[model samples]
Target: MDVPYDLTSYVRVLKLASTPSWEEFSRVALIAGAGIVLVGLIGFVIFVLMSVVPGSTPA
Candidate 1:
Protein backbone atom coordinates (compact mmCIF):
# COMPACT_ATOMS: atom_id res chain seq x y z
CA MET A 1 0.00 0.00 0.00
CA ASP A 2 3.01 2.32 0.59
CA VAL A 3 4.66 3.26 -2.71
CA PRO A 4 7.63 5.10 -1.19
CA TYR A 5 8.37 2.25 1.21
CA ASP A 6 8.34 -0.22 -1.68
CA LEU A 7 10.59 2.01 -3.77
CA THR A 8 13.17 2.29 -0.98
CA SER A 9 13.16 -1.50 -0.52
CA TYR A 10 13.71 -1.97 -4.22
CA VAL A 11 16.61 0.49 -4.16
CA ARG A 12 18.19 -1.37 -1.24
CA VAL A 13 17.97 -4.62 -3.19
CA LEU A 14 19.62 -3.04 -6.25
CA LYS A 15 22.45 -1.66 -4.11
CA LEU A 16 23.32 -5.18 -3.00
CA ALA A 17 23.66 -6.50 -6.57
CA SER A 18 27.19 -7.07 -7.87
CA THR A 19 28.89 -8.83 -10.79
CA PRO A 20 30.05 -12.39 -10.15
CA SER A 21 33.74 -13.29 -10.56
CA TRP A 22 34.65 -15.62 -13.43
CA GLU A 23 35.33 -18.51 -11.06
CA GLU A 24 32.03 -18.04 -9.25
CA PHE A 25 30.14 -17.62 -12.52
CA SER A 26 31.67 -20.75 -14.00
CA ARG A 27 30.88 -22.82 -10.91
CA VAL A 28 27.23 -21.74 -10.94
CA ALA A 29 26.98 -22.38 -14.69
CA LEU A 30 28.47 -25.85 -14.37
CA ILE A 31 26.05 -26.78 -11.58
CA ALA A 32 23.10 -25.43 -13.54
CA GLY A 33 24.16 -27.34 -16.67
CA ALA A 34 24.53 -30.58 -14.73
CA GLY A 35 21.07 -30.15 -13.20
CA ILE A 36 19.55 -29.55 -16.64
CA VAL A 37 21.22 -32.66 -18.11
CA LEU A 38 20.15 -34.80 -15.18
CA VAL A 39 16.53 -33.68 -15.59
CA GLY A 40 16.62 -34.32 -19.34
CA LEU A 41 17.98 -37.84 -18.87
CA ILE A 42 15.28 -38.67 -16.32
CA GLY A 43 12.58 -37.41 -18.68
CA PHE A 44 14.02 -39.43 -21.59
CA VAL A 45 14.06 -42.60 -19.49
CA ILE A 46 10.41 -42.07 -18.52
CA PHE A 47 9.41 -41.52 -22.15
CA VAL A 48 11.21 -44.65 -23.36
CA LEU A 49 9.72 -46.80 -20.62
CA MET A 50 6.21 -45.57 -21.36
CA SER A 51 6.53 -46.34 -25.06
CA VAL A 52 8.01 -49.79 -24.53
CA VAL A 53 5.69 -50.98 -21.75
CA PRO A 54 2.37 -52.67 -22.66
CA GLY A 55 -0.98 -51.02 -21.71
CA SER A 56 0.86 -47.95 -20.41
CA THR A 57 -1.62 -45.77 -22.28
CA PRO A 58 -4.86 -46.17 -24.20
CA ALA A 59 -4.10 -46.99 -27.81
Candidate 2:
Protein backbone atom coordinates (compact mmCIF):
# COMPACT_ATOMS: atom_id res chain seq x y z
CA MET A 1 0.00 0.00 0.00
CA ASP A 2 1.19 3.52 -0.73
CA VAL A 3 1.78 5.69 2.33
CA PRO A 4 1.37 9.45 2.58
CA TYR A 5 3.24 11.82 4.91
CA ASP A 6 3.75 15.55 5.54
CA LEU A 7 7.14 17.25 6.19
CA THR A 8 6.72 17.55 9.99
CA SER A 9 5.78 13.90 10.34
CA TYR A 10 8.92 12.90 8.42
CA VAL A 11 11.10 14.96 10.77
CA ARG A 12 9.50 13.36 13.85
CA VAL A 13 10.19 9.89 12.51
CA LEU A 14 13.84 10.78 11.90
CA LYS A 15 14.27 12.21 15.42
CA LEU A 16 12.75 9.16 17.03
CA ALA A 17 15.35 6.74 15.67
CA SER A 18 18.30 9.15 15.93
CA THR A 19 20.15 8.28 19.10
CA PRO A 20 22.52 11.06 20.21
CA SER A 21 25.20 8.59 21.34
CA TRP A 22 25.83 4.90 20.78
CA GLU A 23 27.13 4.29 24.33
CA GLU A 24 24.02 5.73 25.93
CA PHE A 25 21.74 3.75 23.63
CA SER A 26 23.59 0.50 24.32
CA ARG A 27 23.48 1.06 28.08
CA VAL A 28 19.76 1.81 28.04
CA ALA A 29 18.94 -1.15 25.79
CA LEU A 30 20.97 -3.59 27.87
CA ILE A 31 19.45 -2.44 31.16
CA ALA A 32 15.92 -2.56 29.69
CA GLY A 33 16.48 -6.05 28.24
CA ALA A 34 17.93 -7.36 31.49
CA GLY A 35 14.94 -5.99 33.39
CA ILE A 36 12.52 -7.75 31.01
CA VAL A 37 14.33 -11.07 31.28
CA LEU A 38 14.53 -10.81 35.06
CA VAL A 39 10.80 -10.19 35.31
CA GLY A 40 10.05 -13.12 33.02
CA LEU A 41 12.23 -15.48 35.04
CA ILE A 42 10.61 -14.40 38.30
CA GLY A 43 7.14 -14.94 36.82
CA PHE A 44 8.09 -18.40 35.54
CA VAL A 45 9.43 -19.38 38.94
CA ILE A 46 6.23 -18.21 40.61
CA PHE A 47 4.15 -20.16 38.05
CA VAL A 48 6.09 -23.33 38.66
CA LEU A 49 5.78 -22.90 42.41
CA MET A 50 2.05 -22.36 42.12
CA SER A 51 1.61 -25.44 39.95
CA VAL A 52 3.51 -27.66 42.36
CA VAL A 53 1.44 -26.65 45.39
CA PRO A 54 -0.84 -29.37 46.80
CA GLY A 55 -4.28 -28.36 45.42
CA SER A 56 -3.20 -27.04 42.03
CA THR A 57 -3.70 -28.91 38.75
CA PRO A 58 -1.13 -28.93 35.97
CA ALA A 59 -1.99 -27.71 32.50
Q: State the lDDT of candidate 1 residue by residue for 1-59, as single tens digits.
A: 99999999999999999999999999999999999999999999999999999999787
Please, what are the lDDT tens digits per residue for candidate 2 over residues 1-58?
Answer: 3345577678788888864598998999999999999999999999999888977865
For each candidate, what TM-score against the reference? Answer: 0.86, 0.61
Candidate 1 accuracy as lDDT: 0.97
What are the per-model C-alpha RMSD values against the true structure? 1.1, 3.8
Q: Which candidate is the best by TM-score?
A: 1
**What's the true lDDT of residue 19 in model 2?**
48
